[model samples]
Target chain A: MLEIATPFVKKAGEAYLLVLQRSSEFETYTPAVNSARELLVKMDPQAVPYEKGQLGIEYHRVDWMGLSL
Target chain B: MKIILGILLVLGVSCSSTNQKVESTATTDETEIQAPAEPLKKRKTKKQKSAVVTPPQEESEPLAEEKREDPYLGVKEAIKNANWQGLEGEAQKILEQNNQNIIALNALGMAHFYQGRPLAAKYFLNKALSINPNSSDVKNNLAYVTKKEGRSRQAIILWRQVATAGGSSSKIAYENLINEFTIAKDYKKVVGAADSLGSQNVTSVATLNSLALAAIVKSEFDEAEKLLNQALEKENNNEALLINMAILQLDFKKNLDQGRRYLDRISFLGVQSNRRDIVTRLEAVAQSLTNQGEVK
Candidate 1:
C-alpha cells in the first residue's frame, strides 16, 4: 500500500493529520512505511484497509483565519 | 496621496494666524477710505474737463488699490476656492513685497504646483524650506514637486524625512513612498516602508495589497500569502483579493487544489463585471493544472 499523510482538522489551532492509502509502486514495504502504518492505526483506531487502485487523500482544510494547514 | 498632501499645504498656508493682523490692517484702511465716498454731481462742464484727467487717475487707481489690498487675503480666498490663477498673482504680489514671507513662499509654490509648473513649484518651495528648514509642510510640497519633476530618488528621500516627522504628515509620506517605490519596482523598500508603519497604521486594504504585491515581486511566497490572508480577513468578499490569492496559490505556490478552492469561493461570491477577466484567468489556470496532472 502507498500511504500518504496530509493535514486534517485543527489540533489546538495547528496542523493535525489523517492518513490515506492507495496502490503502492514499491515491490516491498519498508520499515518506515510499517512504522507509519502503526502510527496511523494508533492515531485513528477505526482505520480502513486500502482498496486496489484507490486514490490517496484528495482533500485538506486550510485554516485561513490562523493560516495553518 | 499627493493630491491630499497638496490640499493640506494649501489649507495650511491659508489658515496661518501669523499674518492675520497685517491683512486686517489693510482691510480696515480700505474700509475707512471707502466709507467716505462723495456722491457724483451732474456737471457737464466739469465732466468734459475731468474726463481726460479722470481716465489716467482711474487707470492708476486700480494699480494703487491692488498694491494697497492685502495680498494674503487674495491668497487665502484663491486657495479656499481652488483658483490657481488668482493664487499665483496674489502669492507673487506678497513675494514681491517681502521675499522672506514663508507663508507667501509656500502659497506661491502650491500655486505653481496646482497649475502644473513643478519646476517653479520646486524653486519657491526650496526658498521656503531654506528660510524654515523644519517646516514639514514645505518638505511635503517639495517632495511632491520633485516627484512631478521626475526626480523620484530625491522625492523618496524627502518623503522619508516627512514620514519621520510624524503625525498626519507621516501617513501621507508613507503613502507617497509606497507609490513611488511601486513605480520604481523597488518592492523590497516598499515592504520595508509598509512594515515600518506597524500593524495599526498598516491596516488599510490598499497598504495590505501593496505589501502583498511587494512580497510577490520578491518571490517570497510565504510572506505574500500571510499579507494576502490578512487583507482577506478584512475584506473577505473583495474579488481582487480573492483573485490575488488564487493567482498566488496557482502560479507561485503551484498549489492547484488551494487555487481551485479560492476560485470556487470567488465564483460563489459573484464575480463583479470588472473582475470577469480575473475569473477567466483563474479558470484557464485551473484547466492548465488539470492538464498537467493528467500529463503526469
Candidate 2:
C-alpha cells in the first residue's frame, strides 16, 4: 500500500505548493466545489458517503432556511 | 527485504562507479573461461545465458540513474498547463518502478483532481494519507478533492487543520475555506472564521462583506449597517454592499426614499441587479398604501 500511495503523496505535495504559487488567480472550479449550499441540496438523496469514511463531517449541516439553491 | 535492499545497493554502486561495469565484464569472462569445458556447445550455453542476463541488469543501472535525476520542477509545470493525463501517466510509471514512493501517489492524485475527476482524486489522495496521515499536503489535497465532490463540511474541516499547520500553503487553504463559506451564504460561520483568521493575507473587501452578511443573518441590523458603511468608506459606492444595504433598508427601515436611492444605484450593476425583483415588490407595497389612503 505504501508502494501504491507514495506517488500520490508526492503529487498532493505539489498541489499544496501550487495553491500557494497561484493564490491570486480566481479558480472557477474550486469555488463551485466549496459551495456548501449547493452541496447540501445535492446531498439530500444523491450524495454518497465519502469512501475514506468521513472523519467528522456530519456536524456541518446546512441551515435549510438559509439555503439559496 | 534484505535481499531487495542488497540488490538496490549493488545496483546503486554499479550505476555510479565507472570502473564497476568493466570489473563485472572481466569477472564474467573469467568465470566463463574457468568453467570445465565438457563440450564446446555446453560451455557456450552457460556463457550465453549469463551474458543475456548481465546486460539487462547493467542497462537498468543507467535507467535508475536517469530516474534519480528526475526534474520535480517539471511535474508542477505540467499541472499548470492542465496536462493531467501526461502527469498522471508519468507518476504511474514511477510507481510501477518503485511502488513505495510517496511523491508519485501525491502527483497522481493532484492530476486527477485537476482533471475534474473527484472520485478518482479521492481514491489516490486517501491512499496517500493512509500511508502518512501527518502529511499536511495530503490532507490539503484530500480536503480539496472532498470540496470538489461537493463535500463542503469535510473540506472545511481539512482546510482548518491545514491552515493551522504553519506554512504559506496552510494560510492559503484557510482563505479558500473562508471564500467557500462566504459564497455559500453561511454567514454565521464566516463571522467566527474571520476572528480565527486573526492575521493573514485576507482582503478587507472580502472580510467586511462576509461580516456584513453574517450580521444581517443574525438580525443585528445596526452591526450590518456599520460594517457596510465601513466597507463603503474604503471602496466608495460599492455595488454589492449598496444593493444589500438597500434590501435591508427596504425590508426593515420603512424609508422608501433612501431605499429607492440605493435601488437606483443597483440599476447601474446591469446583470447583477437583483433590484428589479425588489422594485416590483416595493411598487406593490406602495400601491397597497395608496389604496389604503383612498379608503381612509
Output the number of the lDDT-best candidate: 1
Instruction: Name the lDDT value of residue B17 in candidate 1.
Output: 58
DockQ of each: 0.02, 0.02
lDDT of 2 by residue, B1-296 (tens): 99999999998887778687788899989977887567887776667677856575578889998877764544555655667888788778778887656667778887777777777877887787788887777777777677767776777778878778866456556556666666654444555665666433444655565656656555677876776677678876666667566656665554566666766665656523433554565545545545655798
lDDT (Cα, tens digit) per residue for candidate 1, span B1-296: 99999999988887875479678999989866875564444344356556665665578789889877745667777776888898889878887888898878887887887888877888888898899998776787787776666666676778889788886567667866765554333445666776666535566665666667666766777987897899789988877678778888887788999999999998898887856865786689789999999999
| Candidate 2 local distance difference test against the native | 0.59
Spell out the clash pairs found in candidate 1: none
Off by over 4 Å in 2: A1-69, B1-70, B89-104, B163-169, B203-266, B272-296
Fnat for every candidate:
0.00, 0.01
